[model samples]
Target chain A: MPALILFWILAIVCIGAALTMVTAANPVRSALSLVVCFLALAVYYVTLSAQFIGAVQVVVYAGAVMVLFLFVIMLLNLGAPVTSSTKGSNQNTAAVALGAILLLVLFISGIFFEIPGKAVSPATAQAQGTVKAVGLTLYNPHLPWLFPFEATSLLLLVAVVGAIVMTRRQV
Target chain B: MLTGLVAYWDNLRDGIYRLFIFPEYWHGIRLPALVPYVALAGIFAFTLGILPMLIWIERVVIGLMQDRTGPNRLGPRGLLQPPADVLKLFFKEDIQPGSIDVRLYYLAPFISMLVALSAGAVIPLQTVTFRNVHGGLYTVPVTPGNVNIGLLFMLAASSLGVYGIILAGWSSNNKYSLLGGLRASAQIISYELAMGLSLLCVVLLAGSVQLDHIVNAQNTLPFGIHWLPSFLKGSIFSWYWLQSLIVPVVIYTVAMIAETNRAPFDLPEAESELVAGFHTEYTSMKFATFFAGEYVNMLMICGLNASVFWGGWLPPFNCFPFTFIPGFVWYILKVMMGIFFYTWLRATLPRLRYDALMNLGWKRMLPLALVWLFLLAGYSLVRTATAPHITPTAVVTVAHVAPGR
Candidate 1:
C-alpha cells in the first residue's frame, strides 16, 4: 500500500513536470523541469523492479543528456523569454501541425498499445534486471533482438563522426 | 555484553558512519536489527566529520611540501582549527546578490553537496557479518544497501554533480562565474567518458559492478592469472592494475583527478583567471559546503580507487601475519595513501593551461581509454576461446535449519 501511494505521488510529479517543461517561458526552467520529469520516470522504473533501467535512465537521460542540453542553452545565452522562431512563418505552422499529429499518435498509442512479454514473477524480474542477467540476454547469439542492440553501436559511431565534423573548424 | 557491542561497532566504524551517527541504543524495544542502521548512521557521521581533518591534512601536507609551517595557532598543532572555521562559516551572513537567480543559486550548492555526499551509499568500507550484544544475526554493509548496480549508481550520481557547478555559475550573474561553470561542465563531461571506460575494464575483470564483489574478485590472484606459479599468487602485487596491465588504472587515476577538479585540472577555478570561479558569489555555509564537498569528494574518489584498485577492507595478505589489525584499519591505511597521492600531485604539479587541459582530456585520455578497452575485451575473448574447459563436480551438502518470518 505504501509503495502504491509513493507510485501515485511520483506519477503526479511526472505529469506536472512534463506540463511545466512544455509551458515554462524560460528555456532553462523548461530544461530543469524535463530533468525532474526524467527523475520521476526513473523512480517509476525502480518501482517496476527495472533497477538497471532506472539507474541508466537517470545516468543517461537526467545526468548526461540534460547536462549537455543545459550546456548548449547556457552557451547560447538563451535564458531570456524564449521567442518563437519567426512567428507566423510557414515553418512555424508546419511545426505546430507536426506537433499536433505527434501528440495525437502518442494519445492513441497510450490507449491501444500493449507490450508483448509475459509477466515474470517478482523474483524473476529482479534477477532479470541484474547486470549479469542483462548481459546474458543481450549477448545471447540466438536471441532475435541482438541485431537492434548491435545497430545501437553503429548509430553511436555515426553520431560521434557527425560531432567531429561539425566541430572540426572550431578545434 | 558491552565488549561485544564494541566488537560489532568497531567493524562498522569506517569513514561516513562514525562522526555524525550516535548509534542510539534501542535496547528496550528489542528491535531485531536496529544495531546496523544505528552503526550506519554513525558511519555517515564519520564521513562528514572527517572532512575538517582532510582539509587540515591537505593544508599541512601541502605546507610541508612547500617548506612552510601551516595553521599552528589554534589548539595543539591546529587541531581545533577546523571547528573554528566551521563556526565562523556558520555565523557569516548569506549574502544574496540583487541580480542573481534566487532559486537556482540556493539549490546549486545543495545539489553539489548532495551529489558529493550520496556517492558514499555504494562504497563498501568492509564486510560486516558481526553479531550484536543481543545475539541478533544481521550483516550491515558498509554501503547502505546491496544494489546490483553499485558502481554504476555512484557514477550516475557523480555525473549529476556537474549540475551544481553549472547552475551555480549560470545563476551567479557574473561573467567570471558563468565562465567557471561552463569550464566545469565541459571538463566533467569530457573526463567522465574516460572514467567510465576505465571503470568498464575493471567491471569486465571483476565480473560484477558490485563494489564488494570487485574487492572479492581481487582477493584471488589478480586478473584471474591462475596459471601463476603457486608462490606468486595471492599477494599484494596481484592487485588488479598490476595483473591486467596498468592502462586502465592509469587512465582511471588521471580521469578521477580531473573529475574532482583537483589542482592540475582545476580550470574551472583557475585563480589567476576566473577569480574565485563558480563559488565567487557564495558566502557563509554555501561557500563552506562547496569547500567541504570538494574534500569529501576527494576522500570518496580515494576510497573508491582503493576498493576498485587495491583490496578495500581486505588486508594485503589473505594469509596474514598481519591479522592482529581489523579490516577497517587496513581500509584507512590504503585510503590515506590515495589521499597522499592527491596531495603529492598538488604540491608537485602546476595547473594545466586551459587548452592543454582540454587537449589532454579529449585528444589523449579519451583515445587511450577506448584503445585499452578494445584490447582488454579482445584479450578476454581470446583467452576464453583458447583456454582449457573444466567441468564442475557437484559436492552438495544440504542442511536444514529453522526458517520463519
Candidate 2:
C-alpha cells in the first residue's frame, strides 16, 4: 500500500515535469525540466524493484546526457526568450497532433495488449533485478540475449568511431 | 571490571540495534519507518560537525607545509577560526549581482550542498553484530542506506553534482563563472570515467557491488596465502590497494582528486586564471555553502576511498592492541589520512595546465584504468579456471512407482 502511494506520487511528478519540459520557452529551463522528468522516471524504476535500471537512468540520462544538453544550450546562448520570428510557426499545432496520435496508440495498447509473462511477485522482481541475475540473463551462453547484447556494444563502438571521424574531418 | 564494561557496551549496542536495526513499535507507531530519516539526520550532524575541524586541519597542514604558523589566534592556535569565519559569513551582506537568474542563483548553493550530503548516505562507516531475541547473532552494516547498489548510487549522486556548478556558472551572468562551470563539468565527466573504471576493478575482485561486501571481501589472508603469519591475515596487506597491485588505487586517487576539483586538478577554480571560477559571483553565506559543500564532498569521496581501498573499518592487524580499538575509529582515521593526502598534494604541487589536465585524464588515466581492468579480468578468469574442484561421489536411486501400480 505504501509502495502504491509512492508510485502515484512519482507518476504525478513525472508527468508534471514532462509537461513543463514541453512548455518551457527557455531551452535551459526545458532541459532542466527534462532532467527532473528523468529523475522521476528513475524513482519509478526503483519502485518497480529495478534498482540497477534506475541508477543507470540517472547516471546516463539525468547526469551525463542532460549536462551535455545544458552545455550546448549555454554555448549557443539559447537561454534567451523566444523571439517573434518563430511566433507563428504552427509547430505547436503539429506537436499537439503528433502527441494526440501517440497518446491514442499508447491507450489502445494499454487496453488491448496482454503481456506474455505471468506477473512476478515483488520478491521475484527484486531477485531478478540484482546485478548477478541481470548479468546471467544477459550473458548466459544458452540464452538469446547474449547476441543482442554484444551487437549493441558493437553498435556503440561504431558510433564512437563515427563521431571521431566527423570531428577529425572538421579539424 | 573489564567484563562489566564489556557487558555495558553490549547493552548499549543492543539498544542501538533496537533503535536502528530491528526497530520496535512504540505507542502503536512503527519505529522502523523512521530509520532513514534518523540516519539522514545523523549523517548531516556528523558531516556538518566535522566541517569546521576539516577546514582548520587543512589550514594547519598547509601552513606547516609552507613553513608558517597557522591560525594562532581566536581560541588556541586559531582552532576557533573556522567557526568564526562561518559566523562572519552568516552576518555579512548577501550580494545579488544585477541581471542574474535570480531563482537559479539562489538554488545553486543548496543544490551543491544537498548533492554532497546525499552521496554520504550509502557509505558504510562500520558493521555491528548483535544478539536477537532468539539468541542468534546477526550482523548488519551501520549505514544510512545499505542498498545492494550502493556504489552505483554514489556514482550517480556525484555525477549529479555537476549540475550545481553548471547552473551556478550559467545563472551568475559572469564570464569567469561560466568558464569555471564549463571546466568543472568537463573535468568531472572525464575523471568520472576513470574513477568508475577503477572502482570496477574492486567490484570485479569482490564479485559484489555493495560497499559492505567489498570491505568484507578484503578481510582475508593476503593473496589467499595460508602460509603468511596469522597476524597478517585480514590486515592492511589484504586490502584492495595491495590486492589489486596498487595500480587501481593510484588511478582512483588521481581520479578522485580531479573529481573533487582539488589542487593539481583544480582547473575549474584556478584562481590564477579564472578568478575563483564558478563561484566568482557568489558571496557571503552562499559562498560559505559552496565552501562547506566542497569540504563535505572531500570527506565523502575520502570515505569512499577508505571503504573501497583501505580496508574500511578493519584494523591494521589481527592483534589484541589493534582489535581493542573500535572499527569506526579506524574508519575515521583512514578518512582523515585521505584528507591529509589532499592537503599534502595541494601544498606540494602546482595546479596543472588546462591542456595538461585534459591530457592526463583522457590519455593517461582513462587508458591505464581500462588496461588494468582487462588485466584483472583475465587474471581472475585464469585463477578460477586453475583452482582445484571437488568431485562428487556417484549415487544411484530407484524411481518409485505409484502404490497401486
DockQ of each: 0.47, 0.45
Question: For this target, which candidate reaches the highest DockQ against the unseen true structure?
Answer: 1
DockQ of 2: 0.45
Give stretches of model 2 more than 4 Å off: A81-86, A111-119, A169-171, B1-41, B388-405
Candidate 1, overall lDDT?
Answer: 0.79
Runs of candidate 1 with Cα error greater than 4 angstroms are A85-119, B1-39, B130-141, B222-234, B382-405
lDDT of 2 by residue, B1-405 (tens): 976875676566556546544424456565545555665776678889999999899999999999999888899889889889989999999999999999999999999899998899998877765445565656667788889898999999889988989999999999899989888988898899999999999888877788888888888888777678776877999999998889999999999999889998888889999999999999999999998889889999999999999999899997556766778789989999999999999999999998899899989999999999999988766655564221001000001111222
User: How well is each residue in B233-324 modelled by candidate 1, as lDDT tens digits?
Assistant: 44577777765588888988899899889888888888899998999999999999888878778877887888888778777764324434
Q: Which model scores highest in TM-score?
A: 2
Give model 2 RMSD, 1 decimal.
Answer: 6.2
**Pairs with steric clashes in candidate 2:** B71-B77, B71-B78
Give the alpha carbon lDDT tens digit for every residue of A25-143 in model 1: 88888998899999999889888888889999988998789989988887988878857777668996797799999999999989897878985688978877876667666665666
B-chain TM-score, candidate 1: 0.83
Instruction: In model 1, state the lDDT of residue A98.
Output: 100
